[model samples]
Every structure is written in structure tokens, then in C-alpha cells.
Target: MEYKWIALSNTTIGVLMAAINGTIIIISLPAIFRGIDINPLTSFQYLLWILMGYNIVTATLLVSFGRLSDIYGRVRLYNLGFLIFTIGSILLFLTPNTGDLGAIELISFRIVQGIGGAFLFANSAAIITDAFPAKERGKALGINQIAALAGSLIGLILGGILSVYYWRYVFLVSVPVGIFGTAWSYLKLKELGLRSKGEGIDWAGNTAFGLGLILLLIGVTYGLMPYGSSQTGWTDPYVMASMISGAALLVSFVFIERKVKYPMFRLELFKNRMFAAGNIASLLRSFAYGGLMIMIVIFLQGIWLPLHGYSYSETPFWAGVYTIPLMLGFVAMGPISGWLSDKYGSRFLATLGMVIVGIGFLLLTTLPYNFNYTEFALMLFFMGLGNGMFASPNTASIMNSVPAKYRGTASGMRSTLQNAGQTASIALFFTIVILSLESSLPTALATAVTNAGAPQLVPLVHNVPVTGALFAAFLGYDPVKALLANVPSNLIPATAIHIMEQRTWFPTAIAPAFMGALRNAFYIGGIMTFIAAIASALRGKRVIAEEKEEKEVIKNA
Candidate 1:
């Protein structure tokens, strides 16, 4: 009934909705492609767009939305976000085309949803900080962050279940929640946060920053796609041009911010030790873990589950089911860590969390492709606990360091870095995997075909596109089947044909190569998280802004 509780509950719903949509499409992609009558193997561009578009838009817009909320009103923008997001969901659910058109429509609608998500993400933390007292912010933020993580995990399972009956249900499920949230937010949420009364929007800075980030993220997304002879497009002229131009624009944005009267980005905020270190640590942690869930899901769907006798159709649901331990660990530790941080400083708990997460990544490398379920589950749970411990305390430290009038801008900057880091992580990690596969997968495929008494078909299947193979793994399709679709029956014996056709053969053959590539990713992730731990340690001590202000006033008096 209290205003703070009201703010917390509404923002939690907004965050949960935004986070759920972020991941819901991933597990449901196979079914979505089927529903739209599109062949995923031949539609890699559509797949990439569908997967990355929402994140790209959300990441690009958060800072601007945050700045705007500071000038206008946080609650007003947040309510608009809820309404826009609901509209996007409705459009996606009622998609009226098929094939390429359908995929394009879906991508367009998702971008709309991303716009709304940016608004919600940019303001939620600021709203929460404004509503709660300084000492209680950690607990409030912890619950909020927990909703984000839980929503992502819940989206995976929910998508898997709903997609079984109809793909449209995936989008449909968000509609009622969105409608209710929109109405509730508009009616009950108040403009309680301080606002900058007359700061004009810095259009020049906003343009440069938004366009720059858009170009950079788009370049990264395409960089994961195949370009001519290369397995990845990092060297393509267009990709290079986009990235270079994007970098130039971002540099210009920095200068523009320096000269502007009312800049969108609050660069001066970085001078604060707590704010700087907390944000840097948050970005590194996000970079380290963003693609991790997807990678694990791929391992389960493409290899482990299939080799263990689960059908391709069943892999999606089971993959979601098996990851529950990670969620459980997060739920258990989130509140406890928040409460602890409120009593002590965030420095110790936050640093310890990154250390634990780093260790979990390293321990993951020890598992073989056919790792025992118990070991795998425990490792996942361990990583989840580390994330739960870090998220809230770190967020609380960052929000509490800034002045009240700038909380919206600060929150936006934080969300932007976090989202951008995640988007880049997925692109970078996927590229790493694809490059690894390029060198090793062809030989492995050739050898597997020869051993299966299909030497005649070796050359045909050997040079399969690495991107296609990776997509197959993500989509739960058998790459070998698609590769051998055109082969004459007479060219291969019946027994060999049957052997290659079994659901287990390709998974068995690819596991060794895939695991090797995956281990490389894990090693890099471990190193990144460890560096994040160092950053977290560098946050020094927690300083509450209001308390410091009060002390300054007393001394002056």
C-alpha cells in the first residue's frame, strides 16, 4: 500500500516483462521458423536479425531514454514503454505473412519492443532509488535484479512449453501481462524522482551516440555471419566500413558531450570511484556471462541430449528444464547478499562474487562433452550464485553514488553498458566458436563420413558452411542430414545410410570438435570474469550521496 512498495512492484513487473522478451525468442526459434514456413538453414540473416535486433535497439536507446526521463519525467516514459511494448507484442502475435516477409515483420516488431524495453530499463533503477531510503536500497535493488534474472530463466522454460502447441503463443503470452502492467503503471506510478527542469535535449550528441551505437552493433551482428570465403564477416568491406564509421561517430559524440550545455551522457559522473568501478565491473561481468546460457543450451540440444537418446524435437524443452539449477541458485542467494551488502559495504561481497564466478568458468573447462549431469548442474548453480551475489550490491553502490537529479541518466548509462556488453559478448563468442569450427569441423566431418562407409560423400559434406553448422546446433537440427540431402541412394550403402541418418551419429561425431571450441570460449570467459573481480575490488568504499551531503552542510554551518 505504501508508495515505495508500489514503485517496487510495478518496476519489477516492467523489468520482468522486458527481460522475459529478451530471451523468450531463443528457445522458441525453431518453432517460430516452422510457423512462418521458413527454412532456418537457408535463412541465417533472418535468424541473426531476429536474435540480435531487440538487444541492439535496447542497448542503443537506453542512455537517450534515461536522459530524456531526467528532463521530462521517469514515470511518464515508463508508462509509455509499457504501452509500446504491448503493441509490439500484439503485432508479433498477429503476424500476417510467411517466409521472409514474416521474419522481417517479426524483426520490425521486436525493434518496437526494444524501444519500450529501453525506456523501462533506463528508468526502473532510478525510480526504485528515488522511492526507497538510502540504507534499504540494496534489498530493493536485489529483488529487482532477481526479477530480471528470473524472468530470463523463466522465459526459456515458458517458451519451450508454449511453443509446443503453437508458436504464436510465445508472443501472445506477453500481451495480457503487458496490458495489465501498462494500466497499472499509468494509474498508480507517481513522479517522485527529481528532474532537471530546463535542460534542453542535446540533439547533436544524441544523434551521434545513437547512430554510432546502432552501426557498431549492426556491424557486430553481421560479423558473425559468413562473408564470401571467410567463416565470419569481420573482414568484409561493409562490415569494416560500418565499424569504422561507428567508432568515429562515437568519438565525435564524446566531444559533443564535452561542449554541449545539456549533454545526454553524463561523463562527469565517471569521476566518482564507486560509480566508475561498479559500471566497469558490471560491463565485464556481462561480457563474460551473456552468451554463456546460449552456449550451454546449444551443447544440450545439439549434442548431449541427442546422444542421450532425446529426439531433436524434445531437446528444446529439456534444455530449458535442465538449466533450472542455475535459477535456483540465483534465487537462494540474491536476497541474502543484498541484505549483507546493506549492513557492510558492497566492496567485499561484490569482489567475492566475481571471484566465485571466475572459478566456475574455469571449472567448466574440466568437464568433458559427456560430463556427468551432477557435475554440470553443480557448476551451473555455482555460477548462478556468484551472479546473484554481485548484481544487486553492485547496482546499489552505483545508484547511491550519484546525486538525485542525475539518477535517471546514471541508470541509463549503466543499462546501456550492460546491454551493449551482452550484445557484443554474443557476437564475439559466436565468432570464436565459428572460427574454431572452421579449422576442425571439416576434417572431423570427412573422417566421420569415411568411417561410416560413405567416402564417396566425404568431399560433398566436408566443406559444409561453418555458420550453417553452428545455426543447426542452435536450432536443434542434424547438420549431416541437410548436407546429404542431395546424395544419390546408390552412392551409399543401406547400412551406412541408416547409420548416418540416426539422430545420434552427427552429435557423436561433432561433440569432440564442438567441445574443443567451446572450451576455448570458457577459458576466455574465466579470464574476463577474473579481471572483473579486480575491477570490483577497485570500487574502494561505499559512499552514500545523501549522507555525504548532510555531512558537508553541517561542516559549512
Candidate 2:
């Protein structure tokens, strides 16, 4: 009994850290760029690696490590994750070099942190479910989900504070937490769950899956970059080739899995409709989720908050502050939804939540280019409400359905799908924004800079790459403002400086173009969430999968 609590506490801490760091880098981008002393306009790839590296590493390694946990021991592997994550944090704090190299090194270390995060996320839920009984599992999972949800937002706030004083402090904050978690988990975590052995390492399946997924993800990654005059690079020769090759490999890997004696992914799991349907729903929801966070941050930092009079420097911190509506909504309903799900089943709540989320997106679309606070806050609140309803229950359903022996792999598979979906969403959204910025950003920047009195620098302004948008976003700074700052003071009004620095100027300058891009992105987001709702609704009632006569009858044939 005590062990269950201990397990819950430790897993919660690890997951909390993992979830927080997932986004901690976003709001801290400005500080990071300044610390490293690189012009973000020229540092597009670095920005992508820094932002996407953690996600990509976690997504790629989750399933493999999950399988390893099943064979070795969840507790042993989980504790190792703590140590690795801590070490990564330390290395990040002591990052060497300067400029692009330093940025690259920091990103490299972050990838290591992501690897450790994969270990924690892949097995945390399964470990908790293993410790607790069925009745308590829903409640337990709810708490875990709450920590995850809260931790994400908390990262925004923490990053804002820590980045203000010292950019490295953001990384440093995790060190103490990681050290405690590592030692505590090592001393206290005890694995009592089913552990599979002698699977003899499915090398063929592992290699095929790893290579196939990497190729596919890389295709997705490059697809988001610019491709000569196109807003997006989906048609890039390289991206297209990668996608085609990755698909072929994945298809071949599926065949190899069936023939292998010990396949990492048991193809048979799909035979269970609930598991398959739940995963589909989970993936759909995650797609929207991954994109939504970035969009919301953009809205707040780049558009709304800034328009309302927040400077770029202060935008990151206030962005976190303003997002409290969502946080409040999630906290209020997280446990309640879990309790409701336990009593009434997950399908209704999850589907209903998706409906609410879709509606929230619709409401957001209706807001004028300039909207009032009440409307914005209310919309965000509803968005939070819908998310709160879905996240906890959906997670519980997925975990509860898996058999004990396969929990590690199943959890890993689930996390992989979710994390992968997150990565894909980011790529997709960036593609939309980057494509939009590619054309409008340069034109707008020249006029904006010229208007600010640096007509001589117009050529240089025009030369700034679209990737500048990404760097500006990561740093929580406005690209327009950065461009305008380059204007020679002698050529423009002194007020030009003040106006360019004004919160509303940048958002207003980029408003029409950003709106053009954001509208399409928001619609896509709504559609994704709506599809998830439909998937959720179709999941129907919950019935545990045990190999009973009816199940066997269905399975044997």
C-alpha cells in the first residue's frame, strides 16, 4: 500500500519534470538566443533542432526503451532515466563555446534530456497501474494526468522567471529536482509488475521500426522547411523522397514483424478493437494538442498580449500569466472527469470533451483580429475544459485495457504515438506559418524597417530569411521589431524607435498576414479535434479484454 503511494509520488515527479521541460525552452528562447549570441535570422536549423530535438528523440526512443523495460525491469530503467536526465541538465548548464556551436551543443544536450524523458514517460503510468488496484487506477491516473497538464503550463511560468535572470537557470532548476528524484526512485521504487524475459531481442523488428520511423519523421521534419518559393516544402525533392522511402520501409517492416519470432510490436494487439480505437482517438487528439500549444503561445506572445501593450521581453512571462484560464479550467475538472469516467465510462466524456474543444476552436475563429479580454478568456476557458475532460479519461482507458505483461511496451507505444503526433503537429503548424511568413514577412519587414527610418538597410532587411520567424517565436520576440531595430536612427523619427518597440506595433504590422495563416491553421486544428471527437464517440463502452470464450472465438478464427 505504501509502495503504491511512493510509486505514485515518484512517477508523478519524474513525469512532471519531463512534461515541464518539454515546453520550458519555448518561453526561454529569447534568453537562450542572447546567451548564445547568434542572429536567429541565420539560425533557422538550430532553432528547429532546439525545439524539435527533444520531441523527436523522445518520440523515436519511447517504444524501444519501453520494450527494454519489459525485459529488464521498469524500476531499474526508470531510475536510470532520472540520472541521465540530471546529467543532461548539468551539461546544459555548463554549455561551452558561443554562437551556433554553443546553440548546437545546448540542443544536443537537450536531446539527451529528451532521451531520459522518454524513459520516464514510457513507463510511469504502467508502474503506477501496477502498484494500484483496478478501482483506484482511474483516480491514480487522473492525478498523474493533472501533474502532466499542470506541469506543462508551469514550465511556461518557470521559464519566464528563470530566463529573465539567467538563461542557464532554466536548465539549472531541473538539476536539484532530478537529483532528488533519482536518489528517491533508486532507494524507494520497487517493481512488482509482470516482467517478460527471454524475448531474445527482436533485432529485425527493432531495426526496421527504428529506421522506418526515423526516415518518416525526417521527411515530416524537412517537409516543414522552405523549398524554393513554396510556403512549405512538402513538395521538396528530398522530403518527397524521404517520405516515399520511409513508407516503403515501414510497410516492409510490418511484414518482417509478422515473420519474426519475437516482434517488438505484437501485431495482434490491433485485433482488440478497443485498444486500436483508443489509440486512433489518442493520436487524433494529440495532433491537435501538439499544434494547439504552439498556436496559443503565438497568439498570446506574438499577437494578443503584445497588441494589448506587453513588450517582447515581458511577453513570455505574461503569456504564461494570461494562459491561466486554461490552467484553471484543467485543474478544476481533471479529477472530476476522472471520477465521472470511472462511473459512467470514458467514451461519453471523451467524445463530449472533443465536441467542446471543437466548439472552442470555432469560437476562437469568430474573434475579430482585435478582440476583448472577456471573449478571449472565455474561449480559452472552454478550451481548457474540453482538454481537461479528455486527457485523464482517455489515458486511463488506454492503460487499463493493456495486459500486465505488455504494459511497458504498450505504454511506450502510446507515448510514442502521442509524442510523434506532437512532433508532426509542430511540423505542420510551422509549415503553415513559415510558408506564410516566407512571402509576407520580407515585404512587411522592408516597409516596416523603412517606415522606422532605415531605408538604407531595406536590402538587408529583405534578405532576412523566413527562419527568422522561428527564432523570433522561440525567443518570444517579434521579428518585425528585430528588423526595425537595425534601421539607422538618423533616417527616422525618434518616435520610430518607440513605436517599433511598442507592443501593438509588431502584432498590428504582422496581423493581416498572420491572420491569413492562422485562420487556415485554426480550421485544420478544429477538424483534427472534431475527428478525434468522432473517434472518441465511436469507442463505445468499456469492457476489459480477457481471453474469454467470446474473445477466443473472435481471435481463433
Who wins the TM-score comparison? 1
Q: Whole-model lDDT for model 2 versus the true structure?
A: 0.81
Tens digits of per-residue lDDT for model 1 on 1-557? 99999999999999999999988898999999999999988888899999999999999999999999999999999999999999999999999999899999999999999999999999999999999998889999999999999999899999999999999999999999999999999999999888999899999999999999999999999998889889899999999999999999999999999999999999999999999999999999999999899999989998999989998888888898899888888888888888888999799989999999999999999999988999999999999999999999999999999999999999999999999999999997898888898989889888888899888887887668888877887787767678778887888899899889898899888899999999999999999999999999999888999898899999999
lDDT (0 to 1) per candidate: 0.92, 0.81
At residue 468, what lDDT does model 1 achieve?
A: 86
Which runs of model 1 end up more than 4 angstroms from their true locations?
none
What is residue 15's positional error in candidate 1, in angstroms? 0.9
Q: State every prediction's TM-score relative to the real structure.
A: 0.99, 0.92
